[model samples]
Target: MAKGTKSTWSLRRKLILAAIAVVVVLGLALGLGLGLTIGRNGGSDNGNDNGNAPTPTGSPLPSPTGKLPWTPRVNDTWQIILQNNIELSDDATSVTPNVSVFDVDMFDTPKETIDTLHRLGKRVLCYWSGGSYEPGRPDSDQFQKDDMGKELDGWPGEKWLKLSSDGVRTIMKSRVELSAQKGCDAVDVDNVDGYQNDNGINLTEQDSIDFLSYLSNLTVPLNMSLGLKNAGDIIPSVLPIVHFSVNEQCVAEGECQTFHAFIDAGKPVFHIEYPDNAGSKLKEDIVQNFCGDTGDASGSGGFSTVLKKMDLDGWVEYCDQSVETTALNSTDQGS
Candidate 1:
């Protein structure tokens, strides 16, 4: 072979080898880049990855007390009138001592009231506003202007809160801590269904689901049962987490069946029907229609019904023709 031809063939062979080496290096680099990207994305569905993805930093499930296994069932007779500082009557004979539960305002119901009920062997559920901002509450000023959305209709000085706000959740956490501190058995977190009303914050059902999940995580840890208050639409999502359902005027609004999910889940639905003359006079028909017919409202079986005034004063009339009214002094009337 000629020297020039041999040299040219050698040079061509070297260029091909160099090109192959470069391609191999580029392929390895691309694979490494993709592996790093997947690791940063935390591409695991098991929720165990802690790379760039956010780690859930809050409380855990099954609670510290192990998810309240207690189910509040119907025929569970109860009395709850959240007026100001009215005490449960010491005279058990005259006051119907068979009452199973008593729900009262967290702040207004003094520790003595809870102690008195406990002495009477009654379960007490402390009430708190978990979604709305009330001007009279102790933590009212803690709510930021941005956290408030709009004033509630017909309710003066009360505003709907942004369900996703950290500030609002902090205040609610304080309220739950207060309920636990008060030795209450359960918590009736009110105004949780702000999405159902004109909340002005564009809150959705998912927002309420997240909020209730957060709330249940808080209360269940303290061995305190939590009640879903009147947010029937999100029942399927929240029923598994909550222990009871406090429904208002389901018969009037024709939404009683929505609450039956709680009952079907072996949980209690504390049904309250506020008739037109609830405060002034007791309407026999309203009481009969609510608890009487099994199919009157929505073909659901029996429900624990109570006749209450709009303001939720101490006056209560059960299906069995029993009436109990609180006797409050001027100071007890916190207004």
Candidate 2:
């Protein structure tokens, strides 16, 4: 994990977590973001997060709830963000970027916007910070001082949450329920990899795995899909429970190989990589490696990869060098 350039200061922030695929976390340190498979009773009781649920005792086995909503498939193209609300195209038969999915801010987006994406044949994944506390989210007041620890470096107003806390688990369960109510096909629970960082909560790898199991229970009953965001080490344990995985910088950090479990298991690894140098255009070699790391032990043949800037706005460039800019509303432009 040698250091990278300045535009990738975000990359450097992640490299600080060396070999842990900490790249997606730079945005976790901020936002750009980004589902579940599940059972009915893995965490707390249904729709009953009083911010006082118990720690997940091993994941309840995956018991199909008769019907499941759209679980993102392997090789599904997608985009992600949390800093702003996504604005879809007005055309009813067509969608901007025309990707199979759009992963965006959960609370910030209106249900009408999600409904619009649905009309255009897209599965929407709502993003929520599941492992950390942000000062501005609608549920900010619910977090107690003892429930959280140190702020995420380089990202203001964000702190690593105590994953083992019964109260914190309840808040996360509430969020999963919200995603279902808002019509999200899946929920992307970010920052669950806090155990891999300097998260002051002293989180452990098992803590993350257990928390993921807990999240799965909440969505499975609703029939909403779910994804594990970049806690690669726990993939083996949670793979049966989650629908897919949302990853950051596995290519750049050379850990793309580790997520083969997701691909081999017939699930998607929604992967992203910021360039070694930001601001500079995507160099030919960089694009070649990210999209074409094919047919090898390290080659990620089935990953749905996207090249994005650290901010994770609508602008996206694919492996083929084609680019699409989704429209951003005035409110999303920091206006």
Candidate 3:
């Protein structure tokens, strides 16, 4: 062959080889891109790339938002008394009213008290302010000024909280963690309905709903039941996320039906009614009037009513004509 002709043939051969390499690289790149898209869409059930598998096209799996296994449910026939410090009887065999549930202050009720109640086959619900800042609470200082909004009307030193604040959520999460650490079966998150009040920050019902959703997300993973404390307006929205409803003065306010949604949904409403005069003084008429004597207490028959004083001391009067006060020793009473 001529020399120039040989050089041109070699150049043509090199060009052909380069073109082939480019085609192979392009094919591999396309395959990898397709595989990644499939994997990103959640690998197929058969563990193979089958184009027949439908692509997830809508709403992106809800953005992994809110808590899971929501609306932690509590068992029925459980007696709950909201008090500062619940004292066990002298025999210590069982608590009074044959109570099966006790809701006491997180700070005041000791671990031993919860253990005692657990020993008696009772479930303990630790009470704390989730949306309010209480002055006397141990973690009171953790609240930032921006997290606080307005003072709760009747609660002297307590104030509403900014539910969306990161600082507030972190503090509230720590409180829930403390409840679980203290062996509480559930937590009573109080004053969540700041939107209903003049909460100073113009908080809306949606804010409360989002806050509860956040809290439910935190509580459920810990296997802890989360109770909604008197946030009636958002009941329809949060009913599916909260386990129970801890209501105060619903019957007295003639709004028992607002909380009955929990009962309708097969969750308990731990109802509390404060007699105008009873400061830990058990009154039979109050119990009968509230808990229903022949269907008279605000007409909703199945309410679990407990007569407590305004201060929520150890005394509790139940519907079954049983009255017992958890006696607090001087130290327990904070004397």
Best by lDDT: 2
Quick one: best TM-score, which candidate? 2
Q: lDDT at 273 for candidate 3?
A: 79
Which residue pairs clash in candidate 3?
Answer: 67-217
Quote model 2's TM-score. Answer: 0.77
Q: What digit string (tens of lDDT, one per residue) describes model 1 on residues 23-136?
A: 999999999999997555433221221122221222245445332323355557776777665644655433442678787889888776687777876788888888899998
Q: Put down candidate 3 lDDT per residue, 99-180, tens digits, no spaces.
A: 5677778877788888888788777788888888889678899999888888899888788899999999999889888887
TM-score, cand. 1 vs. native: 0.76
State residue 224's C-alpha deviation in candidate 2, in Å.
0.9
Model 2 agreement with the true structure over 41-97: per-residue lDDT tens digits: 333343322222332233354335444444677788887766577665555566568
Stretches off by above 4 angstroms in model 2 are 1-65, 89-93, 276-281, 294-297, 331-335
* lDDT (Cα) of model 2: 0.76
lDDT of 2 at 37: 26
Instruction: Please give each candidate's TM-score.
Output: 0.76, 0.77, 0.72
Clashing pairs in 2: 35-187, 35-226, 35-227, 36-225, 36-226
lDDT head-to-head 1 vs 3, winner = 1
